[model samples]
Target: MDRHKVYISSTYRDLADYRARVINFFLSGKMPDSFSLISMEGYVADDIQPSDKCVEDVAKCDIYILIVAKRYGFIPPDTTKNPGRFSITEMEYETAVSHNKIILTFLADEKQVFEEDSDPDAALLAEKKQKLLAFKEKVRLAKLTHPDGFTDAYHLCFQVQQAIFNKFFTEIYASREENLDKIYFCDRRSQNYTFQKGRQINKAIQFFLINSHEKDMAHFFVKRIGLECIESDIRTLDLFIYPTILDNSDFDDLEFSMRCAIKEEWNRNAELKKFKLKDPLDVSVEKVLSVMDELNYDCLIISWEIKSFYWKNDKLNENISAFYEKYDQVNATLKTSKKIFFIGTVSYSECADMTFAQFEDKIKSIRYGATPIKLTRINRNEIKDWMTDFEIEDNPNVQEKLLHDLLPGPDPDFYLSDLELPLRNILMKL
Candidate 1:
């Protein structure tokens, strides 16, 4: 008989360090000797591509561990190259979903959730952005009914092992009576119930000013599941993060688009002080630097086109040195890793060679330590491509029906015939 194999998947930013620690805890442990597990870190010696190995591992393994964190995984870092591929974390989830593999997920932060009615930032990222929120809803529902969601970190390892143990001992080897005792999992507890939101919620929610009322929702979920029955119910859990930026300003379309597409967290400031300026260049750079100082973020995602103008300003050529000086000052003060990812070309028509060339020159001038950096230029071409993919995956029929049914009249009309030519045509025909 073959042993069941398990594979673990995670995003490296924000939660990778913690995930590695958890994996190590399980890897360097006293196991039942019969059980087996494999991970991405294990395949480094084989020279196998991480994504390929992950696909293979998920295919072979009976179970997969998805470390759901706030950050989306990286794209190839060069959107000018291949943009059709999946992020590392997304590839893992997608593979598991397609293969129908039993995925055992651990939600890193459960308290944070998408507020359905919030004003959307950047109309461009709305589609991908909405998908992320919907995914969270599904995971939240799954956690409410899965065994893995209820178990503590200590017992989580034991319970997963015990599931394997039951299959071998009871299924493979015939036993007279079922292990009924194992089914009724209960620990010594004098108190009826105690609830506390995880630490990730506290740290993350602070930046967004998410009120206590929002934070307290996690406890409500725990209560609904019931302490004793929580284990028996939940089978597969999902991790989700409600993302926000500093200054309480909504995450911009560019930031939202990049973050959601890649499934990585944007390095955001906790808060920023106001510095009014007449020049757009001065205002932008000054605001950026102020936020960077407040947040202590090592990485900065500069708007490629805007930053280039500042670099090329004739009057501020000497003064622009001050901008570079401030950048250096921040670099010197950095205590942790400072990696940057640049976003470019939200519209494909804007993809002039000069725009990219200008961006490249500006990027080269910004000095930092030997930090890993990636520049993603998302012109109209990429947006159309992304839009096409989203259209395919997102069941447009359901939405269409919903719109038709929910609207006031038989015909869903929003705009006049002449003004809304394209949209009116599509809506009317559909």
Candidate 2:
């Protein structure tokens, strides 16, 4: 097994016992063999600068564990350009943050006051308490999640074990990659169909659906998707649906419905019930690029009705064009390793002599190295036939099967296999 180096950061004098307990917990037989804890106590050399060495160790570590207690720790001399005076512990955290290390923070229980009345410097003690509270508050407000509080060394040990286990499960075991496999599904319509297709490939893929529609519709879609995943026998899945609503009129209700759906569906699966499900993240379509950047998605699957992108000279159609333009720009700026897939479909009734030409031109305009797979003219009769043939009871499953049949294969004229080959190749690699 590949070993992971975890750097421990905390006030040495105040949290020495808690830190020792955490280290010992990992060193015990219960912990996995892949993890090894590192702290300043393990450092034997005195000739090198302590602060520099701390930063170096933090940079090299695979994970950073920060424990916040009552003390502010020993403030090292200001040797760098940073204006704020940070202790050796804070410096280690800053180094970890700068290097973009995975940080796990454990806060000491606020009920227990570590400061003693017999302390020599009362004012200094008060200052340290204020600093510690402020630091804890700062961490709470940060983007990182899972900052837990512990009552004592035993409580801290259990919390540490749980946190590390959850992290390893989601980040490593779930994806079977160095980093989590994040897939962003952008669609104005219900994404249950798209999700069905995605699961057919990799059920373990993390899903983040961005729906630019009404809150009620988003709730309906999320509920449907959750139920489908549950019924499909997926043992564990990380799913998040963000509804892009303009107002907060129905946000609360939508959130409540989504939470209920997740809780109920997840309860049906014993393995999935162990993991905590977060509330639906609300975001606008305009912020899609920012969300993509933040999540660093491995694959982006964008599905849209071909009619929506048609040049109708209407404001909504123009907005759709602008959306693709932004997508093109974002894709151009992204690293080559990031895969972008465009799934375009048109109904048989919506198709015309100029439909193919128009769709081809629109795809070319939005082309920034995105693999475009245009589903051949689909009709109600063909869909019904497919559903009957496959004996699929669900509409979403039928739709997914129909779309899959439209992909390039042995048949050439009926499917755009040439254009879909590249996208299929990428999906296969994933």
Candidate 3:
């Protein structure tokens, strides 16, 4: 029965009808009963000052919605030296910003400006217009407002509904439970590979599956966690992924091949058949961080090959180094608040290419407050043995057995365990 408080701020005289329409839309048709609208219409009282009441209400609001038209409504009296200069609407917006509330601004089309016979003097009107434009520019520069224009009350109502649904409903109400954990799996892979049932699941294949079909994997991860803690208070899981993408030159063909392989594998399993999947697409780190802030993710899982950290070319090395530095900053900022699992894979040949010192330096640079789980080396002899067994093995179940042999077991390396213990210690803090 929890409700979200929304404060509507605007120059009332010109936008009165538009405001009424929007409030009606939310109260009667668009939103659920849990949304409470706060506006000037509801603050009328005999003794209380309207401006003071509006500011107080805005401070308590969870979301702030501002509508701006051509007219600059009545400017409230200011007690300071700059008295009667700024509109009450502007004051409400500043109050919302001070409280760090989620603000959404809707700019009305200029053509729909309201006309009044008793309008303010010409100079005052021009100054008000300039101030409104300046305010719009400020909000736009902050990247906080949408670019769409509203021509009528109905159009404005529709825009408000869309904004509410996208930002509030999906990101907040739909997954609001404190017991629901949001987990993201970021997979940076060179190619897509298939997995065999009995054979062990390698890091590359695990990354591909986790990133490409996160919804399905959510169920799997939740079930696995449930097995470990039967009486835990956690009740739900929300999974997300950052997918892999090839450059333009190599994308078309590889994407098609990956699709076919995925379809074939999915068709073979009944449970997977019930699930739908799409090709994974690359996303920027900024976008990932934005989602984390909005959804309040509980954990993030990132896996990559060791070679991805190495580059023979100086420029490529610099680029990778810069990326990790930015990544380190972000991780440090959120370390105390969230749980992170970073897994690195090393092929036997790759490990042999570096001395102990070189390998140790690589590990130190990429640790970034993460539990670095190193996959066991895969050697040529093991590959040969697997190929030889595949030819002679008659049971269809041999593939599953081979997978079990190859995948990392429950116990990781000592270093990985050392890094994980501290992280696990803080998981129950929330």
**Top-TM-score structure, candidate number:** 2
Models 1 onward score TM values of: 0.32, 0.39, 0.38
- lDDT of each structure? 0.36, 0.47, 0.46
Worst 10 residues of 2 by lDDT: 179-188
Task: Name the top lDDT candidate.
Answer: 2
RMSD of 1: 27.5
Model 2, span 190-281: residue lDDT tens: 24444444432322112232222111123223433433444455321333322121112243543344434434443454544433344333
Clashes of 3: 14
The stretch of ten residues in a row with the least summed lDDT in candidate 1 is: 204-213
Better of 1 and 2 by lDDT: 2
Q: Order of candidates by lDDT, top first?
A: 2, 3, 1
RMSD vs true structure, all candidates: 27.5, 21.5, 22.0
Candidate 1: regions farther than 4 A off: 17-30, 42-50, 77-85, 112-131, 138-430
Against the true structure, candidate 3 reaches a TM-score of: 0.38
